[model samples]
Target: MAKAFKVPHTLTLLFGMMIIAMLATWIVPQGFFQTFINDANREVVIPGTFSLVEERQYLTPWELLTAVPRAFAAAQDIIFFVFIVGGVLAIARRTGTVDALIGRLLKKHSDKPQKLIFMVIFFFSLASGAIGTAGEYIPFVLILVGLCKAMRLDAMTAVGMTVAGYGVGYGASAFNPFTVLIAQGIAEVPLYSGWWLRAVIILPFILIAFHHVWTYAKKVIADPNQSLVADLPCPLEGKEATVYPELNGRHRMILGTFLATIVIAIYGISQHGWYLYELGACFVGWGLVITVLGRLKFDEAAESFIEGVKDLTTTAVLIGVARGIALILEDGQILHSIVNGLSMPLSHVPAAISAVGMLVIQTILNLFVPSGSGQAFVTMPLMAPLSDLVGVPRQVAVLAYQFGDGFSNMIVPTNAVLMGIIGIAGVPYDRWFRFCMPLLGKLMLFATIVLVLAVVFGYGADLEVASVFINNAGVVS
Candidate 1:
């Protein structure tokens, strides 16, 4: 058989286009090309350049230099925490504990498809909540994919469900320190004030995602010879089982300690809200439990931990580089420029269109910067003020951020977790996108309509909250 020839042109073109677009965004002064509208009447005119280099305030040179190390440190800290979790889980898997647990759970649910789908969504949602960081969710995603295969489900279907469930949950997060608290803090709203409302809005999307996945899986099962099935990549190779030496008493004790630690951690979080301190304590406890349970020497455990951290080094580096792009945009004061330029045109649109527009913008921004915390830092300051000017409440603006950030994760090329998942599943990015884009579109539309209705009905602060008025006697004096 003659092999088909392939060209690398597409990859090269994509990289070239990305670089050019980034450079264009970087060099253009904030608002440089946004002079078409008069501020008073919002009338259009010929667009002209407006440089902020002289008038704009931004991070000082010293600040920029200082931020690099600070950003790297923060990235490293996140990577370290994720690695510890991964290492502990890896050790647990090696002990056959996780395998036994997964087997039992799968068997219990396999008889009921609806129950199985709900269970999958529930666990993925729980993992998203537990991990609290998109980057940290990679291992969980891979685990879910493997579990799906074990249940004889289609891999892509599993990926779609896991991504949809997790993304929606994370989008409507109630207590995520990174996304919810940080975004609310930046918007100057009381933390978790609109949380219940946010959850309400996102619930429909979550249900839609469940339906989407279940239907897709059934379609594949019913027609195994479908073209869609042919398009998906083969199951990942080299998945043969391996035997390990029977655990000694020390290993058993260690395994028991590790399981107990996890239970305690979950219970504590449920009883008392999870804060940074709690998270730190959990990490330390888990690491110790794994070290003791694995019956490994200090050096051996350290090596395992280090190896886990090393696995995350590439992701950490990517994060830093991505952060650098934000730094440069901030340094150039272009982020503000970009926001200001878009706000007026968006405001002129109908409320529904404007709301959807905000979602779209946030999604594009997410492609370059996937960290929710980092994005909030860059966008909320601008978005909040703009929302007030455009007759949208601060809560709506926050929701827009959440919608854009969360939904786009399923499609964005820059999300490391998505890439990691694709790599693990042996599915190509294009194939995953083709399968997921329609579902994402439907959910995005559903969310947009919900937001539009909320605004129309004056839900949240838009309803009861009003500007204060002080009046003396109606005097002509």
Candidate 2:
């Protein structure tokens, strides 16, 4: 008998990547790009300023061992944010709100599961595209998993719905501040300029994503053997599987309080400039309010909160290790060398082809640099100027940045948000990789086509107008 080869555990996979990154420090040339703060108050790379350092910077094996804690410290904001959301949602689940809602959804949508799938993908996509929501959706992962099980689908289907919306929204983001806004501002294009195309294009991407997920879901429902994670343990095991509490005033209050918190959080983000800390505080506040409303003894609520966080331990560790991988590259000083080498050839290509080339470069770079805004900071300055040399519009470059960063997040091991989602869902990285790679191919193909069309049509004409207006205003002064 032949035994099947197995995928390593998530921790093993992440640590393996960290080791590889450490070894690369010894071999890859250490280099850097000179940077300056632009008018927008961003530190941006000065074009053509790349230089190899006289002394090489390489990380030691000892440093690789210690990078874990340092990465946790660096990513503490996101880690704590995940904890807060998990703890708060656990308390809500104890209130029977989650179970009640699941029961209601199953009754209403079970007959036509496609409706549930579409709505889930659409709502998630809308949130990510409009307001840059990703980590906030962590609370929904288990909730959707339970609902899908009730609807006779598998865990992979649940994950596919949540992440597909998230990934595609980002890929075709009309105005995501984390990726698009930062990329645009760094590229020196007008803020939110040339957004109509993204807004229009997002629908098709969403539809394609919906079709892919629904198709898989249909198969899983038709035959249990068709499920990707059938052999894997249940994510909902050891946790409350489901509850059908009768609707009560307290449950409504909790649901309202949760929805109100999201609205307030969104408002704070768009207006007062909130980040993870503020958002975490908001979720914590929701936890406190629900605690009082659910009438839990202090000890009971506290235990539930701790239990909720306990389940997410793997997710947090994976996130920290993922950050550590990026840290190693930074310490090695090979980050800029990779960026400099990959971008040079694009300068020699035709405009339309160069536009597509930017997409490819951004996709490859995303594997090394997974943070959306972080990638913008590292890549945009070069991509913005390179657009001029190759006859691609700066706005199109920003679009390339958006498309590349958004879709690749689904498959990139360094994407902490992704690791968190699938970990919480109990889907192994190998299984997730198997499911997501094909979808990424389709979305990437669509994005490449759009970038070429944008180049053909001159997408950034308004950048010239905006620049002229700024220059004329300076002349008057």
Each prediction's RMSD over C-alphas, in Å, is 7.8, 2.1
Write down the TM-score for model 2: 0.95
Candidate 1 lDDT (Cα, whole model)? 0.60
Q: By TM-score, how accurate is candidate 1?
A: 0.71
Q: On a 0 to 100 scale, what is the lDDT of residue 420 in model 2?
A: 85
Per-model TM-score versus the true fold: 0.71, 0.95
For candidate 2, the per-residue lDDT at 247 reads 64
Model 1 CA deviation exceeding 4 Å by range: 1-18, 30-51, 55-87, 123-136, 174-177, 181-191, 222-236, 240-288, 291-333, 420-427, 461-464, 467-477
Model 2 has an lDDT value of 0.88
Candidate 2: count the clashes: 0
lDDT of 1 by residue, 36-150 (tens): 3333233221223334555544345555556556545645544455555656555555445555545655667655656677766666665554345444344455456556665
The C-alpha stretches of model 2 lying farther than 4 A from their native spots are 1-3, 38-42, 238-243, 462-477
